[model samples]
Target: MNNSNQTLTIKEQLQACRSKEETFKTLVTLSKILQRLSSEEKTDENKVKGCESAVWLIVEESNGIRHFNADSDAKLMRGVLVAILSLVEGKAAKDIQQMNLKVELAELNLSSYLTSSRTNGVLAILSQLQQP
Candidate 1:
């Protein structure tokens, strides 16, 4: 087994949010945390394409593991982006692939907030990062 196999699962990390309000609140908090940061510090070569707005995601290998950094021009959307980005960041590619992100998002009750296309777009981003 790899070192990541011993780490907590994504679903476990997400145990903090039990409601949509809480999830959205968490997103807001994340926005505050990322408010002062620049788009330059986190630039991944394999950017997230196909977003309606300009969105960039940067992933770097640290000690052979991947860490994700993402940003978008849209304000609220960046919060949303961070929500997804925060979940998968620091996780290994293969471990991220094993997560049930759709279910996790739905549990957060964010499905109604996103159109089906945008939902698929987010999933696609995760899928892209999961690739070796």
Candidate 2:
């Protein structure tokens, strides 16, 4: 699904969560929906810096749309990556460039639940994805 619809679905699901543990469980479920990266795709070039856990992101563009595949050694980080990537995967580059991931994460109430370092790591991934 495209970002707008997928984002709403994520929001609704997260909003329905009653507690942090429940929220995390929901996130883990979302992570399961993401495709895992192949060993060949887990090179230095794809590695996301600043993360405490090893994380990789593979980006591909076609016909002006960007596609992202990501993975992380930590299960929670995997879910976090999926949550962040769902906003931009399969989206047009122009549209993605217009997005503010910080604000998006705030709207989702995710950043407040993460540690400062983890939030920084998330921002690091956002920085790479938003580069011109």
Candidate 3:
């Protein structure tokens, strides 16, 4: 399954994974998707701090659109990155600034599985996006 059909939101994707094994599949699928980004697009400017593994992101702000390019080494961490993408992708930076990832994660029921450090990493990515 190519999981790239933008028809389903990341939250919806996570919701579709009702079992532990299914969730693991979702994580692996996300990692596969993110790995498509090129090396130059990956940088410290894009890195997410505090994660249990490496995750980098490039937030493209162009003509009022926010596009996210991200990658992660940890499979479970990839799901965490997707959680962040769920909130801000396709929005303007102004709209992204208004987003509270904490609330979004809570709504998605992701906190139960993610570690505190991993949660901080997601928040850090959003904080990086908040930069001018």
Clashing pairs in 2: none
Q: How many steric overlaps are in each model, in order?
A: 1, 0, 1
lDDT of 3 at 53: 79
Which structure among the candidates has the greatest TM-score? 2
Best by lDDT: 2
Instruction: Order the numbered candidates by TM-score, best leading.
Output: 2, 3, 1
* lDDT scores of the candidates, listed in order: 0.59, 0.81, 0.68
Per-residue lDDT of candidate 1, residues 44-67 (tens digit): 554566666556766677776787
Per-residue lDDT value at 127 in model 1: 70
Ranking by lDDT: 2, 3, 1
Structure candidate 3, residue pairs in collision: 46-57
lDDT of 3 by residue, 1-132 (tens): 122345256678877777877777776676565544578866776667766678887766678876777777677777666766766667777776777756766676565566777667776776886666
Segments in model 1 whose C-alpha atoms lie over 4 Å from true places: 1-26, 35-46
Better of 1 and 2 by TM-score: 2
